[model samples]
Structure formats: structure tokens, C-alpha cells
Target: MTYDTFQPHPDLASLVKCYWTLEVPPAADSQRQRIVPDGCIEMIFTLGDDIKRYTSADEFIIQPRAMILGQTIEPFFIEPTGYVNAFAVRFYPYGFTSFVTASLHSLANKETPLELLFGDTPAAELEQKIIPATDAKERIQIVEEFLFTKLKSEITIDNIVKSTVGALLETNGVAPIKSILKDDPSKRRQLERKFLNQVGISPKQMGRVIRLQTALKMLLNRQSDSLTSIAYESEYYDQAHFNKDFREFTGINPKEFLGHENMELSSIFYAD
Candidate 1:
């Protein structure tokens, strides 16, 4: 397995975290990888064979060649086919809305194919042009050009929603919605509605996921032997609180996660 990451265009930096590429050889024996939410949307393009997303035993679905993965509230599993090669653009919590017109709230927590968002003709044409690019650099350029030209006209944030998200992130998911909305309770409710539409999870839920995400990295990296220390560092109230959240998100405790087959490949990327 080989992976690389790149910076996004300056104007898009706030919304897009980075562009990333991953290539796996044919014999890599792909394992199921879980992608957890991090307060962002994403756009992915496969350069080789297809990828599969599994929901349960005996259920398999092929993802679109090019798709937008909306903010996730929970983990989703993916397995790549032989010689898997792909490039993905990861959006910041606020970045994807700039390029889209249909309420940003409408795409939350789901993977919508590009053709569904853009009209078939336009999306089809863009896919043809991008898929032909022989290298990752050229492919990145194609995506950047499309986004820049499409989003040229308008870039504005819904103030109330932005503030709510800001508060949630700033507090490391420990901040209560009431505390965040003390300035305006009405705005808090509005934020929840908008989050449901655009991000697929309420501000509170996203906050918890973000906190767990922090601890997940620390555990995989062997940063500390004591779960209590990691819990404290990640802002959990106690070891038990950390364990509960971990089980909810990953269906396993911290100890089991390290040696789990399903988590093997993903563990490497988060390791120190």
C-alpha cells in the first residue's frame, strides 16, 4: 500500500482539508476499512477497479466511480478491489457548500454520486475528462479547475449555523448546545435543523464523534498505555466515559481495536 497527500488551492483551504491519493498492489489482500466522520464532506474518484461498501453479511454494494461522501455520523466500511488506485478531496466542515447549490444541508451522511448532484450531461462529461488523466497530479488539477470555475460566483456562510459548529469544534464535543446557544436559544434549534439537512448529524453528535476521533488516533499510535490518560487527554470525563464512546462508535473497546483484522490497514495511517 502507498499513499500521498497534497494541499488544496488557497481559496478553498478552509473547506477542503487536502487532496489524497492511495495505491494498493493487486495482492494486497484488502481489509475492511472504516471511515469515521471528521466534520467534513469528501469527493472521491477511482483510478483503477471498483470499491465495495458493505452493510452486513452477504450484502455488497459498489460505489460510484465519482461520488460525494457527505458527513458521516458513524463509521462505514469499504474494501478495495485489486490494484486499487484513487484520489480523494477531503472537505472541511464548511468547504463543500461553496460549490454546491442544492442546499448543503441536503447531502448529510450519505454518499451521493456526482451525476445525481450535477446534471447527467455535465457530470458525465467531467468524469470522462478526469478519468483519462494518467497521473494523480493531472487528476487533482481537473478537480480543482472544476471547483474553482463552478464556485466563482458566490461564497457565503449561514452565520448561525457556522457559529454553532464553531462552538462545538472549539469545545472538543464537550460543550453543551444550550451553553453554545446562550446568546440565542432560537439560533441553537435552527442550527440543529440546518445540521440535519447539511451535515447529517446534530452539532452535539458531531462533537462526540470528534472527541472519540481524537482518542482513536492516540490509542493506535501507542501514545499511552493507560486508557485513563488517553481519556483525560481527549477530554473524556473518565476512563468509563471514554470506553462507552469508543464502543458506540467502533463496536469494540480500545484494547480489542489494536489487533482487529478489520482495523489493521487503517491502524497504520494513525500510528506514530
Candidate 2:
């Protein structure tokens, strides 16, 4: 398995988090991997075998060759049919809305094909370019060019949402939304509404995902000696609170996740 990330261009740094590529050679024994939410949207392009994204233990759909994975609220499972090669753009929590008119909420929890967001002809052309790109750097350039062309002129992110997401990130997802709002009750409703339409989840939900991401990093990086120690450092009330949130987002326990073969790809991502 080979996973790497590249910085986005300076013009898009405020919106795009990074461009990432994942490549796993065909294996005799491929296992299903669980993917958890991190509160950001992603535009992905798969150049290898089709993969199954399981919604439940018994059902799934083929992940699109080119699609946008919206804000996920829970963990999901996926198994590659063979070699898994993909290039994807990771967006900030409030970044994707600057590119399209569709309600971000409409895309939540599913992979919506690129054609559905960008027109068919253009999306098809873009996918062609990405799939045949000579290398990861070329793919990154292709995606950046497409995003630069599609960015909206009139719909910059709301200042309230911007500052709120800024605070959440600055604190590593522990910032309280109410405190970020400065206790302005009148803006609370509006913030939630904008978060749904622009960020694809409520402010609180994004916070939880972000907080969980921090814990995930600790577990992946071997930063602590035990779950109890990690929980305390992550500001969980106790180990149980940390465990409950972990299972809710990742669908697995901490001990089971560490050094597991199936988690290699995700570990590479989070450990970075």
C-alpha cells in the first residue's frame, strides 16, 4: 500500500485541505476496510478496479469512478475488487460550498457522481483527464485547474460559518460552538442552517467528527501508552466516553484498530 498527500495551490489553500492519492497493489487476500468521518467533503477519482462501498453488512453500491463523498455521520465499509488506486481532494469543513449550487445536505452520506454536480460533458472530460494522468502530480494539477474554473464568484462562505469552523479547527475540534458564537442566540439558528447547506452537517456534528479525528490520530500515531491515558488527554470525561464515541464513529474498538492489516491505509492517512 502506498499513500501520499500534496499541498494544494496557494490560491485554493483556504478551501482545499490537500490532494491525496492511495494505491494498493492487488493482493491475494484483500480485506474490507472501515472508513470514518472527519467532517470534510472529498472529490475523488478512482483509476483502478471498482470497489464496493457497504451501507450495511448485506448491501452496497459500486463506488463511482469520479464522485464527491459528502460529510459522513457514521462509519462505512469498503472492499476493493482488486488493485485500489485513487486520487482525491480533501476540502475543509466549510470549503466545498464555494464550488457548486447544490445543497451540501443533499449529498451527505453518499457518493454523488461528478456529472451530477458539474454538467455531464465537462465532468466526463475532467474524469478522462484525471484517469489518464501520467502521475499523481499531473492528477493534482488537473483537479486544481477544474476547481479553479468551477469556483463560484458570488457565493463566498458566510463569515459566521468561517469563524466558527476556524475556531473548531484552531482548537483541534474541541471548541464549543456556543462559545464560538459568543452566546449570540439569534445567530445560532442561522449558523445551523448554513452549516447544513454549506458544510453538510450541523455545527455540533462537525465538532464531534473533528474531536474523533484527534483521538484517531493519537491511536494511529502511538502517542500514548493506553486508552485511558489517551481519553484523558483528548478531554473525554472518562475512558468510557472515549470508547463510546470511538465505536460510534469508527465502528471498532481502539485495541482492535491498532496494527491491523486492514487499517493500514487509514492509518497512513491519519498518522500524517
The per-prediction tally of clashing pairs is 4, 0
Tens digits of lDDT, candidate 1, 46-81:
878888988775687898888998876666788877
lDDT of each: 0.77, 0.89
RMSD of each: 2.2, 1.2
State the lDDT at 144 in candidate 2.
Answer: 90
lDDT over C-alpha atoms for residue 164 of model 1 = 68
Q: Compared to the true structure, candidate 1 yields what TM-score?
A: 0.90
Error of 1 at 96 (Å): 1.0
Where model 1 places Cα greater than 4 Å from the true spot, the runs are 268-272
